[model samples]
Target: MNEDNAEQGVIRLLRAAAHTVGPGGRLPSVRTIMAELRVSPVTVQHAMRRLTAEGVIEVRASKGAFAATRRPTSEVPDLEWQSVALGAKPPGDESLRDLLTVPGPEMVPMSGGYLDPELQSVAALGAALGRAARRPEAWARGPVEGREELRAWFARQAGGAFRAGDMVVCPGGQAALSTAFRALTEPGDPVLVEAPTYLGAIATARSAGLRVVPVPADADGVRPDLLNAAFARTGAKVFYCQPLYANPHGAVLSRERRPEVLAVLAKHGAFLIEDDFARDLVIDGTPPPPLAADDIHGHVIYLRSLTKSAAPGLRVAAIGARGAAGARLRSARVMDDFFVAGPLQLAALEISVIASMAASPHLAAAGAEGPPRRAAHGVGGQTPPTPARHDPVGRHAGVGPPAGRRRRRRTDGSRRGPRRGRLRRPALVRGRPAGPAPAPDVRRRAARGVDRRRAPAGRRGRGRGDTSRIVNLRPTFPVVIPAHR
Candidate 1:
């Protein structure tokens, strides 16, 4: 073998020997190793040096090599005092940690409202980032309230009286939540939220030292009467709401209830923090205009996020408000990070433009190629699951009615009578028909093995028909129920 391979083999042998010997035990001598492996003294010396460096063995100046002793527990540094200095952790910290925990390779994550890595728009985001990087302005400092074009885009999405001046770009939804909570309310102040709201919102509000009072909400969204009562009871000046596609439960505020909710906010003299994060994720039909769009009186502070609709790394979101609230949001964002990175803002703008243009009828009229259109659609042409219906009661609407309740049809195409039997009991084996036992004579013959097919006399005890090799098929169909038995 070559010198390198010989040296490596010697090291492996020495390592194994070191592990075999107990702590502080003497290992085989260098001369003995050289003699046994039929290698030169240099190989043994090199292996010993490496093992010594690795702490697997120790080589004294005069003494032979020996296994290194493991350090005792008492010799290690103590860290228990840090626990006393840090004090108690905040509530829901563990839950938040669990929520944010990334699933391992073996895990199939079903919980949490996040897009799988497979579903994320990786290619488009990378391309957009590349485009953004090519632009010289993208590397410069951006406005604290974000670029005017991006803000204008957000304003148009907000749809009503919202303008570019009212929009403040933020890092992400959580950061935007933190900024809004800190901006609108003071410490120890009460903030109203829906009963089954986003966990991140709850955690953020609590971290900001605000008392979270839950206003009862159902499938139709938060009840206006309870919301008003909650405001009065808690004396809260701010209410955080998700009118469209509320997280966790995915409830939307009904049209009839929208006016009532607005009236309640006016009655209580409160500001509604509208989280319109999932505005772009429509799977079925068109979503309604944002609640902030309907607010002409400046009671609503609208927050929209692109993190969900776009790739997760595209952490761009906007908070839109009319008057003083808008200014407070802008100031809060400035204090948080001065301003979002220019390149990220530019990349986000690029992605938004591509998505919007792809959806426009004008793009096709411009004679864009099919590949380019599909590429603009995003990674694998996959989009976030945002049901378009105004009031989708979760994902149940997409799934058909339960099997037992399904009605049968007649030959004439009219409705048939109610199911008489146990819904035509399913068979144990898929394609095989289920029925009663065989005739008495057949059963007797089977018991005696008289009617069983067998191999020729000479090959009976071997080959495919060997009794020991034959598999019993009786247990394969475990359950065989019949219509008449």
Candidate 2:
């Protein structure tokens, strides 16, 4: 085709897309455009580039292209990444680790949690590999809502002993979370949250352009009345909390308070985002039923993570969404990616099944079955803290208890500067009140919360990928824990 014809064809596609978008209320994929425009791959690319650049559409990583990003859209375009192709440039000096890495930062890498797949049980993974290869049928693009087997297993696990029919597999806890945020809040809307809930969820809310209003919490989790007050004060639409083994605090919401919390959520028409993260490793108490357990109104969007339980490599999480919530959550996933990874999801399904059997009384304890030997290195700190499930970088970016229980914060919207005395990156924020406040004491850095993790170098390969992380995993997820309220 001539260049002029190409341009005309491109214009034709754009107008068609605009019309299609007007009626369909969503952007069609490149494939649909090809079938519709009856053009080649290059033609669709040319047209999409024009649309995305013109602010008429957006090509969101992982979520695919959507309508132009507007207010309450996303936290920062820098963070919402999909696949990091090998050739894909590293965050171009803005790498995730860049924000965390400190200058002269030669400490014993004990700053955070890391889930190296090499540290996982290879024998079980090998069996899973065989299962997948034998059934290549598992390789097709699986449901964007996640495979039914995984959802059924998740449903069985949600709410302690709830039926499997209640659960739906979300691509990952993050995807499930973003969906929950959309389902519960509106653009430019304010919502209540645990002072320090999952950071990824916070980013997701901001991406949707939801105004965040953090509520206060202690070691036992958020105070119910305080939460209620935040709801009333902010006229918030949703209540986001990590009820069990919460992300940074590593504390479970007290069982006695779970019902009251849910009641408050229901009373307010606010859906409770009980990020039942870290369920597999409750360290101290008997796992309580999730807040979704007795959800009288379909108000709880309970999220479960597998990164901690089976393996982070699975990149799988599920949600036990009730009523119309399930349908909405599915919509968010579809708008992002038509389908979740097929083989990995199938593998996740099988592993989830294994986790259920292993955790059950009928089967021996998963941990007791065989603990992988840790490499003996002269480590300085106490036992490395178990990684929390949510992304720490996301958490570190915003530190401070939700609203009423506010802690001191640096001018920039970042975490309360690294323990008591870690190196503080005071530069990278929204803005700073200009003034030479005081010559800060450089030698005053000391550890605040004692939870430290150090995954030293020299690791073997994992079955999932040909990579080795020098640190620990992203708070390795708890296997199959029930999602019943």
Candidate 3:
């Protein structure tokens, strides 16, 4: 048996022995138990150690095992009274728990939101983190708004006219979302969201004491008319959306709906929190520019995270907004955690720069193989070879016939007729053929359904006597079943 099974068995045996042996009663020695159970001495010792730690038994250095005094049932303290002391507050952690749950060894995971371990750039992240750790100011307290260089990098990533001042580096995308929700809306204020949106967003909004209002979405993303109606009906000032390859369902907002969405948000004079979390996860085609990129009116609050693409522990993300909204976000971040760690900021910057540089070749290759190339081939960017039709067995037409068959040469040295089998069977090569020819009487008996193997030893064929017995055993004609009786 395995070590776990052996340990379990030892534990069970010890527990049973302890029940029979009263307080301070000596039990069987380890060697005796080991011999009785046919287990190793080490397993018995380990089990005894565990029981001793549990107060179920005690062991003296040179003496054998003894059962410890058990505590009376009445002496156990009651925790029932704490229910009245602690007020009711239902946990909103179900979504977070589901998100963080690791699949078992036998399971094939296709549910989680992050990349599988194999896809992550482990070497690049390690190098970046190591380099950042060696810096003298790695542990120093950073600015409330994050490092200026990191902010500038995020600003460039956000595109458009956003400057370093407009970016606020938070711990992660979730934290950025929470900060934005709390900073923008008052408690109980309605916040608009897509109907089938990120569960984390809903949880975060509810935790921030905001009323979540769902706006219907379609294959092209959130419907502009419904969003306008939701904003007007609920009087919501903040809307959270994932425009590019949304979570749970990968749906990219169409180009046509972009302007309509912007127009609706502009008309309502509200903020659109764009969670651009899947920017780095693009496997094919370039993702559209972020909503914040073209927002000249400061209506979009862009949040991008590196944790999903890189390692999970690298909890760094950036939020970009303009004017008063950006100031509010910075203030909220400062109030939340003062600032993100300087080493993490440096590491994020290094990783982002290195990842981008490394991705350049892949991006170039993808670009070189444009739509025409992809369409000409199959969807996976390579054309599959067509099968040959001339070969009767469906093997490659260019291959020669099977072994032991040679083509006959004609007068002009040209092959003619089909190839014949050359390899001789043992029976065929001997005086008898491949299979001995059966007798006519045996064939006739077989056709008549006679069991020759079950016939008498002297019987050679279905003679008159066998025929009479077969007729007697045959079923009667026009057979019928009697009713009731």
Per-residue lDDT, model 2, residue 189, is 90
What lDDT score goes with residue 321 in model 1?
86
TM-score between candidate 3 and the true structure:
0.60
Model 1 quality (TM-score): 0.61
lDDT digits (tens) for residues 1-485 of candidate 1:
88899999898888888789978988988888888888999888988888888899998778898889988867779899999999987533334543454433222222244443444566777988999899999888878999999998888888766999999989998899999999999989988887556667878888888877777566678899988888888899999898876754456788989999999989988999999876655433456789887887999988988886566688888888887888888888888898888988988887633358346332232222222222232211132221221223221111111122322221110011012211111101111111121210000000112111221212111222111111111110011111111
Please identify model 1 stretches exceeding 4 Å from their true place: 1-75, 116-118, 352-485
- Per-prediction TM-score, please? 0.61, 0.55, 0.60
On TM-score, the stronger of 2 and 3 is 3
lDDT of 2 at 230: 77
Count backbone overlaps in model 3: 0
**Best first by lDDT, ranked:** 1, 3, 2
- Candidates 1 and 2, the one with greater lDDT: 1
For 1-485, candidate 3 gives per-residue lDDT tens digits of: 87778878888877888888888888889888888888898888889889999988899889989889766778778898888889776424354544344533322222345544544556667888899999989888878898998888777778765898899998988899999998899988999887556667878887888877877555577889989998889899999999886653345777999999999989999999999886665545667889887788999999988877676778899898889998899888888999998888888887743347336443233234323222321112121111110111100011111233332221110011011222111000001111121110000001123331132222222322121111101110000100110
Count of backbone clashes, every candidate in sequence: 2, 36, 0
- Candidate 2 ranges with C-alpha deviation above 4 Å: 1-119, 160-166, 352-485
> Which stretches of model 3 miss by more than 4 angstroms?
1-77, 90-93, 352-485
| lDDT for 137 (candidate 3) | 91
